[model samples]
Target: MNKTLAEVRTESGYTQEEMSKALGIGISTYNQYETGARNIPVDKVKRISNILNIEEKDFFVPLKFTLSKIKKDE
Candidate 1:
């Protein structure tokens, strides 16, 4: 199973504060990224990749959606 950005961070044993500091940003901003409230810049993503020693591709999560069809009577 794939994990979220927050999960990855926590699994790496780094707190939100530490990650924010390492990225030279505010804690709230980092939280927003993890919570999907804000979009992380490409450069920032690169920075995070370097910091976490993980590939940038790992950060991308594919979204799944289900669509329902309505039945109609002729």
Candidate 2:
């Protein structure tokens, strides 16, 4: 969750337009979700996880090495 959805989506190679089409949602709505302007629903998050073949918890994983730093601090 430390990583923005836009960052993840891009790294995952999903364009906003493509994700919108795949999720049967509007582009603007998807944009809002990606930009953190809107809170993503659990069902949509699940669908995204399924589409990316990643676990829902993975979405909560920080990609910026913050977890590693915390572990080292411990």
Candidate 3:
């Protein structure tokens, strides 16, 4: 199974506040992204992937699978 953004962040030992500051965004905004309440922009996604030391593709593959599954279900 793929790890979530929150999982990766936690494993990397970063608090939401710290991540928000690093991203130059608000804590609420970061929380929203982590909680999937908002879609993170590609630029920010790249920054996040870099910060987490993971490939940028990690963020997108799960979403692609989910979208494809949803389409198939519909």
Candidate 4:
């Protein structure tokens, strides 16, 4: 199954704060990317994928799908 950016980041054992620091971006920006509130630029996606040790395409999973999965789990 495909994973959301947040899921992949959590599995990789990095908190949002740490990820933002590593990416040299603000926590809010990172959160926006993870939560799909804003479109992440390709360069930033590449950096985040590298940090999480995931393929860049992983971030392309549809946000609605991810949200539905989360709701189901809850």
Q: Which candidate should be chosen as best, given lDDT against the real structure?
A: 3
lDDT for each residue of candidate 2 in 1-74, tens digit (9 for 90 to 100): 47677777888998999999998999999998877677677788899888777789866532332344344554
Question: Residues 1-74, candidate 1, lDDT per residue (tens digit)?
Answer: 88888888888889999999999999999999899888888888999888777899877733455889978898
**Candidates' C-alpha lDDT:** 0.86, 0.79, 0.88, 0.80
lDDT of 4 at 71: 46
Task: Score every model by TM-score.
Answer: 0.76, 0.69, 0.79, 0.75
**Number of the candidate with higher TM-score, 2 or 4:** 4
> What lDDT score is found at residue 35 in candidate 1?
92
- List model 3 lDDT by residue over 2-66, tens digit each: 88899999999999999999999999999999888888988899999999999987785223334
Candidate 4 local lDDT, 1-74, one digit each (tens): 86778888898899999998998989999899888888887788788878877777656733433434344554
Candidate 1: list runs displaced more than 4 Å. Answer: 61-74
Better of 2 and 3 by TM-score: 3
Clashes of 3: 0
Estimate candidate 2's alpha-carbon lDDT, on a 0 to 1 scale.
Answer: 0.79
Error of 2 at 42 (Å): 1.1
Off by over 4 Å in 4: 61-74
Candidate 4 overall Cα lDDT vs. reference? 0.80
